[model samples]
Target: MTITTHSVTLDGVEQRYHVAGNGPVCLAHSGGPGIAWDYLRMRPLEEHLTMVYVEPIGTGESGRLAADTDYTLDNYVRYLHVVVEDLAAGPVALLGHSHGGFVVQKYALAHPVDALVLYDTSARTGAEFFGDAVANIQRHGQKILAAFTSQHAEMTNDELTDVLRTIMPAYFADWRVEFEPLRAAMRIWSGPSRGQDVPFDVREQLSALDVPALVVVGEDDFICGPRWAQELHRALPSSRLRVIEHCGHIAHVERPDVFYPEVLKFLS
Candidate 1:
């Protein structure tokens, strides 16, 4: 939990990052494509790797792009390339969650990495991912639908948190339990980058990857389900797919016992 924060200029953008733990440098990226990096603090990872959590160009303490700058996937990859060159001593492990997964995949395609840990992620675009999500919800999402229907206007902070807790069950195999320890540790910092959705298809690009990869997913993840994980594994030449039982989108938070061991083994 002793994290050292660093800010450096990369290609004219003021990039901020947090480093913790000890061992090989691992560049970590959170999902949301916009959520604050704090949402991805995994203490278990600190035991095996020096975790470097990079705030996206416009998130957390990181600087923003110009008004006319293109927020395309290529630009994001360029930014990450500069970050890796600026921070990593050599080829470093790449860890990405959700949309961060997409970024990492593209990054690996452009710049090789020592290893890749893609959690609850896919190689498809937002449209394809959401299309699968809709079908997945229809098949096994009654509770989620009910919770969604019950949402009202302008909830208080606690009420909003309560609703989130209630709906979280749908994201897990166990729909009635809450992981308060993980929940309490998360930091919520919203920014303008939240709605920057870009379309991409990297299934072909993944086939050329040479580094070992770990494709881990939650069995109960509605958005990036087992099939997407499997698809990513199939596309990669050297990769292992692990589906954690009774888990959800946030596999590291939902099942660190399984996640940490698998990741450690892969990195080892």
Candidate 2:
């Protein structure tokens, strides 16, 4: 694949993207609300599809400002439109991971694309999970796990594994075994802006999408599991779902050997 990097103007701001491969272009959007695409390292996927990784306005080496930039979901979607046009490539596949999945779903809803890959992601978030699970984790974090140790004294490392294995994999293709590392390895890059709170609903707009969609997920993804992907696949008229064994949220990164071939099968 021919790899390249360049910049483009969108929303009157300069943005950077990494590119490679030679088939219908496939673009990647990373998670973390402001994570860098380098963490995804899509150069390998580049060999199968012309991969283009976009560094959202605030992440990576892209433009940054100290004022209100209209960082809403619609704004991000609009930014993606400008990106597709900038690529100058026809009928590209738009793919995203985790929170990146939310961005791509919004983008796909707003615009048309040849295909889509939503890797362990979601568009509609359950307040219960985000409010209870996420909030507690953010507040207590590792301490919360330590607290559990007090009650379930016998809940040793293996026991914890069993619990996570049962719950987390319902969302992933591979289950907790594949997802734990990716989740732990993920380094969030949110600016002090708290700008990720955008209310974008795919249910209202997704039914209108006509593009072929692929929902790739890990069995171990505790956040957004296989059920999330399955919901997406069932909703989109032109879509299919796949699960990567022994993989998690960042399935492409953790099990690239499996992810590449699966992605190639769909893209090819």
Candidate 3:
């Protein structure tokens, strides 16, 4: 019932995290590879599970890498491993959204975990995935398309935050209704484009993992849609897939009625 925030020094870098609720521990990693952790807060799930929301390095109060470009998935996984060790809570469940999913997937493969929750994410970043995202943006309109294309390596934190707000509508099924509140609450920091230069296909590697996993995606999510979720399910040996109907990339925010229950049940 109590919420506490803590920061630890690892490898001379600071990593911050928030803890709440009381039950089996669940370590959550938010997306963006740069977005602050607050957006991934699951108050409903907190009632059933202890949630450790991670403030990933390069965002919030967490320390940054020597170079922004150093923010690779492997590096993220390394830091995450330290965080898990610091928790010393034994095997813990890992929940990752979008880019965070990529982190957990890599981490879970190498380390032991109670379970894995992959939300609105993909196992690989391919041309087809980005192509679909572009098509979805085109359908939405020019402003969003422009914002999507405007992203560059040199974007400042404030500039990137502005662009995220501008383009966030495309991340939801019904942006008109959801945009305002999310816009007000959203916080984005500019981090390096992670693992873009390296190949990120984990499909073949997934079969070796015996851990149980739950792959949940927004039915209407353009970038990491049901297609990728299906791909993840097919590859992971002990994985289940759940597609939230009438939702987009941010299912937890848009449809908690469905998202929270499904996740809580899986975790239970």
Candidate 4:
């Protein structure tokens, strides 16, 4: 129930993170590559293990770099590596959601962890996954088309939320009823941002990851659906895949009843 926040500087960037509860360490990374870390603060997991939330650069109290700064995946991996080395004394459970899942995959490749929890993420960041997402939404008809039309480049926090709200249905199986509560807990942050045009393919590297991993996905996630999660599970030699039926993108938020227990069991 009690949570404390802290900061540690790495190469001029003041990295901000939080710690709560007790027991083994759970180093969690939020997605968006630009959003804050609050959304992934799973209260249920806090009761059983110590939770460490790492905010991405430029978001929350974390320091920002210049406009021309490199936000590539490699830069993020280095920053996170320093953060983990500075904080965790021994092997810790690494948890990541969405884009954060991508970072954790690479992190596990570079660092050893007791366990890895990947939520709603894929093995690659290219058209293979995204192209499928587009076609899936189109199958739902014109309303989904209208939602996609609202998307724009370089949007502010509020603008991005508005756009997300329009397409919110695509993220949940029961979006018509559960959208409001989901939106209430959801917080969006947009700091210094840029395009991610660099190539990111790590499927070939997954076979080398020997640590235990749990790949979880919502059966109905429109974007990174179960198919992507299954692909990631197949690639990781020691990974198990769990699909939450009737769930969407944010399974941890939408189906905590299953999410927290599954995670606790794996970490145990």
Q: Choose the strongest candidate by lDDT.
A: 3
- Residue 34 lDDT, candidate 3, scale 0-100: 85
Residues 25-94, candidate 2, lDDT per residue (tens digit)?
8888877565556667677666556778887776657776344345555666666777899888765788
TM-score for every candidate vs. truth? 0.84, 0.76, 0.96, 0.91
Off by over 4 Å in 3: 194-197
Better of 1 and 4 by lDDT: 4
In the range 193-264, model 4's lDDT, one tens digit per residue, is: 464446567999999998999999999888889888998999999999999998988888678898889999
Better of 2 and 3 by TM-score: 3
- Candidate order (TM-score): 3, 4, 1, 2
Displacement of the residue 250 alpha carbon in candidate 4, Å? 1.0
Cα misplacement distance, residue 123 of candidate 3 (Å) = 0.7
Model 2 Cα shift for residue 78 (angstroms): 2.0
Q: How far in Å is the alpha carbon of 173 misplaced in model 2? A: 10
**lDDT values for all models:** 0.76, 0.66, 0.88, 0.80
Arrange candidates by lDDT, descending: 3, 4, 1, 2
As a whole number from 0 to 100, the lDDT of residue 223 in candidate 4 is 80
Q: In model 2, which regions exceed 4 Å deviation?
A: 65-69, 131-188, 196-198
C-alpha RMSD for every candidate: 3.9, 7.8, 1.4, 2.1
Question: Which lDDT value does model 4 have at 234?
Answer: 94
What local lDDT does model 4 show for residue 188? Answer: 54
For TM-score, the strongest prediction is: 3
Candidate 3: minimum summed lDDT over ten consecutive residues — where? Answer: 191-200
